[model samples]
Target chain A: MTLTPILAMRWWLPQDAALHGAALDREMYLALWIMTGLLATAHLVMLVGLCIGRREAKRSIWRLEVAPLLLLTILFGWMTIRAERLWAATRYAGADPAVMQVEVVGAQFVWYFRYPGADARFGKTKPELVQPGEGNPLGIDPGDEDGRDDRVSSELVLPIGREVDLRIRSLDVIHGFSVPEMRVKQNAIPGQVFHIHFTPVHEGRYAVLCTQVCGLGHYRMQAAVRVVSIAEFARWSER
Target chain B: MKIFSTHHRTIGIGYLLLAGTSVAIGTLLSLLMRVHRVWPDLNWPLWGVIKPEDYLAAVTMHGTLMVFFVLTTAPQSGFSNLVLPEQIGSRTMALPWLNAAGLWTTVASLLVLLSAFFVRGGGPISGWTSYPPLSALAEAGPGQATGMDLWLVSIGLFCIASTMNGANTLVTVIRCRCKGMTWGRMPLTVWAWLTAALLTVIVFSVLFAAALMLLCDWHAGTSFFVPAGGVINGVVDTQHGDGSPLLWLHLFWFFGHPEVYIAILPGMGMTSMLLANFCRRGIPAYRWMITTTLLIGLLGLSVWGHHMFVAGLNPWAGTVFQLTTIAIAIPSTAKVLNWLMTLWGSRPTYSTPMLWSLGFVSLFIAGGVTGPVLAQPALDAYLHNTFFVVAHFHLVMAMAGVFSIFAGLTYWFPLIAGRRLD
Candidate 1:
């Protein structure tokens, strides 16, 4: 009946660690507060109406009902526009060209992250060459010169304060690439690639979860996302 | 109880009983899921330690049963069969045999669906949405083979049953209303049933087509929903072509969004009538109530894209769906206000039916205010597929619809059984 446990543990939203997450958290809180207010007002009216009973007076339905509803509609319309602009700002706008590029591959129940290495150019991948047992999970072509320095890992490590554009795709079924702390979620579907970009503001370890139901192993389809200092990230990549 | 008999009350009671059984099983399935969620490692006598496949099977079956049998059937088919003719002053439904046929077919459909649990691979692991290549590829996983086929066939049968019943309701309302039972003169409940039946015919047909297409992809090597380059369980599927998963999303939600209204509109009508009856007066804004009901039905059809904002839909399309989805709030808000206004200043009895009606409104408001929040693509970007969505629909459609079902049963108890339920 109460959220005391949830509140005490501070488990809501899980310590946002991305630069854009604060604004998102603010937007979510604003919407929740507004919705709470609206719910309270409606319930209060219902309670009052039930208690006092109906007055048998001749009244214009327009003034008593339609006008207030119209006002509420306008308010909701404004809120929709505000939320739409926020979405366009985040999802529709292009990321900076110089933003760091990371390839995120989802297959079955595992996540694979690839860095372009010092060349800053991602190597080509072939679907037929995708043999996880052969140590080529992403099927990066061996003949591509740029692929010689490419690095692949099960963990996603990023440098703090650097905007990272994630090219997300799935080799098999559709998978959802989600990180709650970063306010990022996008479906990684086979035969297509989606680009989602964000900047991690704080250095911390967050959970990377597959939000879509890919198969039997969906529950365990998880990975770790570590945001570290630029020097630390360089050191880890070098290792 | 004769299978061929065309009695209206018998079929209605049959529908209600069927729904009751479904809700019972559906609730138990949900309880199993909740228990497993909190204590996932607790080994069971029957299933032992629950694997993810077992958990997903529960999810798929629980959703399928609740949505199809309980929510859709109980509100419109069950209650409407009992009351639509009587309220309109007709002897029985225009096509009573068709009505009985619909009920039994639904029973058979339920059996086919339940049989999936006992199949070799267990019930389908894909959620009720059944998004493919997971759903399309037989080698995708445990449930994707035979269990998935049973799911599709069951859904296909359900579509047929629903379409037949919807047509029967529409015909009875249109042709069988007794003298002077004009459209305006009909009770709000009749109007609600009428609109819901209209939606059923239009949307169920689309769903039938989708289910059949999925079945073909499963057996006939058709690729209506399967795309190329999909590897299932490490096996590459060369059978795929230009098919898209988004196409299925569009077709499914096209029926899926309005399906909620089909579940709720009758309840809205029942709530309005019950609120007025218990309050000892007609709904203050009866015309407005009808208008809002129709508006909800119309707007519900276009907002299916709201469910796909995070499913790779065009951002521009997302904007449009957002507008239409938000527009629904106006009518929905009006319906709630109409109930409150009717309750104002009228001392009403707080009996079982009235309490259920009140509960419907309370839950409706509690659940509905979150509509616009999820309607926004920006917010949904984070909240989609999260428990936020699960809670929102449970509050709005599932729980609210169940409350209305209870309200209808309690209100119509005496008329059908000739005695009040204890």
Candidate 2:
């Protein structure tokens, strides 16, 4: 079966609103690329050093050994300090005070998403009430008043240019929640609620695949993500 | 003690040879998976390419062998089995028979591990954690039947070997210091090994306990990790509802986290000593370096919660575990700086061993930088399971740890075999 395309046409690789977040990804990638280049360069220098500095009858292998060591230390220290700054900016940027909070529950194979109702509150849905096949025991709980206006869907949707807060959890086993375009991923563990904040700058669709092997259906545990224009999202939600 | 005894040197050489073999095998397995990802159309007559069942088995073998066979044993047991006693000036390893037992048992474990391939079902797919329900039942994956049973047994045997080797190291270090080598004068490598062995005492005991419990669930009928009402594959799991699966997690990580250090702390100590010696200067902050080594070991225990932060653990638990995990960086960073400073303003020796040591520091810094980031309760909520995690772990767990072990082997080849190996 031919699946839909994943890489969408874009002016930039990571088209996201959080400017710091976008920059962090590019910087880190470039830093690693440079590191790799420098490493190969050093290896070449070592080869030359071996030829010149070896205990050969014609050569001394010991010229300037200390200098290279110092250079390596400099490279290492610079990378560490640079990495520290990026790590802080990419992962810990403040979350917007106003954003949609969605609770995502992943069990054995499928993912369930619950939207806070008009009350902006998630009603209780007991694990026992969950049953497979017959509307899913993990389905929405209509008993609670707040469950009435809340929307439930297997697909995840976020408004472009708006921050979205994901409260991720797994009802059974471990499942990884990942958005390739966003470069965001976190493990959904039982009894754990992981949170992530990201603002989509491009209006496009992406796939969320489970990176962790939770079970047999793990390979097929795929979710479609729709990053819609703000008006389009509002129109869809209003429906 | 004897200016590099022939026997000690030979033992060191043996470690290099064995570790090399495991690395070769494990690396091949990894490449198989990577290539398979690129070429799913693989077909090898009798051995079909990349079946779902095969992926699980390979994953199981990859993790099992790498973690126990290569990563755990190579550095701590294989190296310490040969080096620590010598480094401490002991004439022979403590309980020499037990020492041999460690090797044989490890061999036996590898045999049993590899034997899973020929078994009816293949190997268990339930990640290395092998949580119950999936791990407790014999029908979870292709090899869930007899193969999983052997997997448990192999691991059990491996744990026994580790305990023996750990005991030997602890005893030799305590009882056999060479003349004038006080605890103060002991090489940092010796300190790291002793500290790692002490940590292993807890690590092996818990894994052994968990293994025995798993055996009981798989064979004799117990529900250590399964839920009673849960039916796996249409058949109700035997005696399920009564077991507390999380107990295994608690016990496993208790040893698992320290086991992480058991893999790295030695490299840290080795790096420290090598840099100091190669630089032809005394290691600055000798007291602080030793203190930090000990602290890295002690603080490692408190950070297990970092693994469970998102497991619906108390939010407050997140704060505590994060603090404990991040606290480790203070001393760890100190060690990194110490290495950099040791080489400052001095002529240094450049050899294959030195190359590996420098690489270790680089990778350690690269990976260790992210440890604190992932430790943040809030931040880990995002970066915990991505390729980012994969990168960090690969850097430290295999790259730094395995590379340093490689360095040790190359550096000490003359001592072991009397001929330098490039």
Candidate 3:
């Protein structure tokens, strides 16, 4: 069996499947072009020096080196400014109040997602009330009035083109909530809650992966993310 | 008695041997992981099926060994011990006994770390970072039991050894330079070693303190890292509360980011020295290269927050880290340009050392470019903990350091052995 195909694999990134993925791809390509240009120039200079330059013709061309350094510094600064804007748009910008909010709690080997019911509020949770399989995987207080209609599902269902605010949590260990296609990842820390927002650009099924090595079953910790139409999402939520 | 004497050269050779052994073992572990990745279900007669726990253990060991033993040991201790004194025209280190003690301590630490595999739980799967709650609670996984304890002990010991080694190197460079061997005339490799030693002194101390705190949480019921309300396997751990795992992340990366520079700076030094020597000319911007090395080291400290961007750090703090991280590219780019300029307008020798130096430059550039992308908090949110990260770091830190080590070994083989391998 030849390993050529595996060794010759050229693609380094997974497909862009999120609404903002195109921006990331563009930034990546821009970085690639800059890097390639710099690398080629450096190698070409070395090649010319080795081939044609006389050994005794050593001269300190400080300006030649400084020129590129200045250019690179300006480019890097501009890129950073642009990146800060993109980052702010994703992280610092407040999530839209009208969008859907989902609570995702990661465990040793599973992902549990909770959708606020028609009330649009999450129920109170206490660590003492957590029981994995006895109808309280996320430990929602049974007595809390707001939790009565909360829909807990093993799978994550999001509506296409609609923004999602995910408040990620963990029950035990640190687990990473990663969806390669959606270009989203955040660590689910046991004692902390992390919020990330993204909109699904395409309608399809994607895998929710645990990127952190949580435990023995870390590799198998996954759930299906189904992006459906708004009507279908509403129907699923009602059920 | 004389044969066992604590000479700097002997100590250096010992460190190299230990580092070489670590590289061998670490490579074997990585190969095992690769095999498991390609053929997950393959069962061998002796090793049996690769269990998930086993895979994690192998990964943990591979990273720990490579980072601590091979990268840290070979470049700073292994190379510096033999060459630093000679470069400065000193016959011995400022404190020869401390050098030997550091080497022996490192050896003992390696033994303790390897003994984790023999423990009942069979090595910690927490990876090299050993993030808490998972690493703190024994009930979290099989490896978190006795194995993690041994891992911590081993690391604590190694940190102590590295501290001693760094002090010795720093003092030697400062006070022991021979007459007329000014700092300006000293080789870039010597400067690299000095810078690496300085970083080791500062960073390893923090790591040691963190390890002690982690150990305290494990044994003394301290909640330095184990946050409150941690439940593992349906059992609520009631011992510790109010501890934030982010504290561990902050502390670890504070040392960890500089630790990457500690690994690569020496390689950069070696590449610069080799390029200048093989080209038989001065590097175009010699002072700038040294200044940039210092700048990169200083900037490395502030950029550690980039690692925590996806770990739920405040967005504003992430932005600060992103800016600092992007700024680091300036010094790094200057170094690359200087290296190319060193090669320009000279009789380029295609020797093995020169070849490896060229490879290092190319690989470092390729790896350095991806860094800015990850420096962006938005992009890092997606790339963190993925193969993309693994690829970036492996290119920058792992492969680049390995190439420089090869270059150094090849360049110095003849001087040490009186016969060149080639």
Candidate 4:
């Protein structure tokens, strides 16, 4: 039996479904345990001191102050290095060149996903041509040959086991694109394209939430991300 | 007219009362948001079926008021005015007129902020961080047009007021100390106010400039924060030229992170003073305590990028900020250790103020332990903008500030009101 569900019962974090998520969860748990132990010890010391009233003051400043502080410095220094390395594993390193590419666009209150069709390249988009009512929400330019085969969908469909590189941006304001199950969160800023890569290890559907408060519809701003078998994803993309 | 009196004590009481009212309204707004969040369909007589924009407006106003009017003012402007001069053996602040001016400007800023709700689109939904082009463009959202302008203007006025207050604190602490009250001999509370004032003088001015830049972007068609954006609300943003949203993040967080120190340092000082007094012993290693206080203030200004780690900040820059944030934890840890050491092995009085100090210590530790966790960019990747960040700040900054405020009120009630409340 896996310990993840049992851990989830008490950790209160969402189920980890991404490959990088387990390490992230491990780092988080380690930090939490260290902090919890320190917190309890500090409180216990305070309680003991308060109860043990009027004892002669010990002149050992080094024992009392310097040693503890030095220990904390070293401990936290180690944790910081570990956490930064883990974070850099995704952000500082580039994804494989052969990985799948998807353009994720965030509007006022919606999330739109686009796939580079047969051309395997995204079509150029213009802000002016964006009219969701006109059946073109991402504003695919008509003149660009790469634009013709681009497929736009409200939901994101991914093939399991493939590393997907997401080029995320917003049409208006700043919106946070967060999928908790994937342990992915990045701001979709206007005039900026942030590329984040992650691999899915599970085939279940997950909720894509807008973490940044966008507008009146922000609460309901969500989409579905369905991870499917490679064969199923191939058939779906072709359609 | 009485509220306009220039007496530092009266002005201090005015600040305390103002913060009291603000905390009331701010707490009510938060409660409304919380209830609405849990029961999205829950309807109240005053605010029926809270919309997302309404919820967001509450968020913006709640943060602005709690951070500025309550946390910033109560500890430094309110409690310090009541006790700072007395503790440092000064008859009055170095610049009384400036203190009075700061108070009046703050009052005006509060009025203007409240006026945003009555305007066309209600309060701006952008959070107190107020990252633009959401805060810059007029047609970005329901409250982006007129409401945001008022928000900027109000914040500008607050920046000016805080700058004035900081100046007065610095001048009083530096110049007005009575004879024989040397720097080392000065109370920790005075040192806290001095360092916090120094931070305020520097950072609030930067925030003022940032607010002005955003205002220009809004009406003057300047592209300070709004980039050559392709579109907002289906309208091509042609009026604005090249600008980066990251510029706003840099300027804002530059002020924003230090603003946290500005709010909490005075509380930390008060905790030190109270713990020593109630514990029937002086705080051990007073010099180190002062050094940590100043170190926290100094290091706070360098760690703003930690707020932007996942906001597209370069990975290398994020690592630098991560290191600085962890460095800050060293001083914070030493400070906590100092508090615990002071309380050790002494017959402590459990008076109301003592309880408040102890409570502040508890909250501070609970809130602070999470600092290193969130400071790491890896953890922040998933935790930034989440409720975890919210709880961290609330525990460490906001609620702890409130606790310190109460500690001051209980301890200094006789000084302010000529009678103890408890």
Best by lDDT: 4
lDDT of 1 by residue, B80-158 (tens): 9888899999999999889988999999999999999999989999999999888988777898888999999999999
> What residue runs in model 3 are displaced by over 4 Å at the alpha carbon?
A1-15, B1-3
Clashing pairs in 1: A53-B344, A53-B345, A53-B346, A54-B344, A54-B345, A54-B346
User: Can you list each candidate's DockQ?
Assistant: 0.75, 0.11, 0.69, 0.72
Candidate 4 ranges beyond 4 A from true positions: A1-11
Among these predicted structures, which one has the highest DockQ?
A: 1
Cα TM-score per model: 0.97, 0.77, 0.96, 0.97
Cα lDDT listed for each candidate? 0.89, 0.70, 0.87, 0.90
lDDT of 3 at B11: 81
**Candidate 4's residue-wise lDDT over B1-422, tens digit each?**
37678788988998999899889999999998889877999877986888777888999999999999999999989988888888888889889999999999999999999999999989998989998888887677888878999999999999999999999999999999999999999999999999999999999999999999999887777898776755766778788888888899899999999999999999999999999998877789999999999999999989999998778877899899999999999999999999999988888889998999999999999999999999989889889888789999999888788899999998988978787674
Report the C-alpha lDDT of model 3 over A14-59, residue by residue, as the tens digit. 7777888888778767766776777677678767876775567545
| Predictions: Cα RMSD each | 1.8, 7.0, 1.9, 2.8
Ranked by lDDT, the better of candidates 1 and 4 is 4
Candidate 1's DockQ:
0.75
Candidate 3 clashing pairs, residues 3+ apart or interchain? none
**lDDT (10s digit) by residue, model 2, range A59-133:** 111233334435555655454455445545545554665678888777666777777856778776655556555
Question: Candidates sorted by lDDT, descending order?
Answer: 4, 1, 3, 2
Query: Which scores higher on lDDT, 1 or 3?
Result: 1
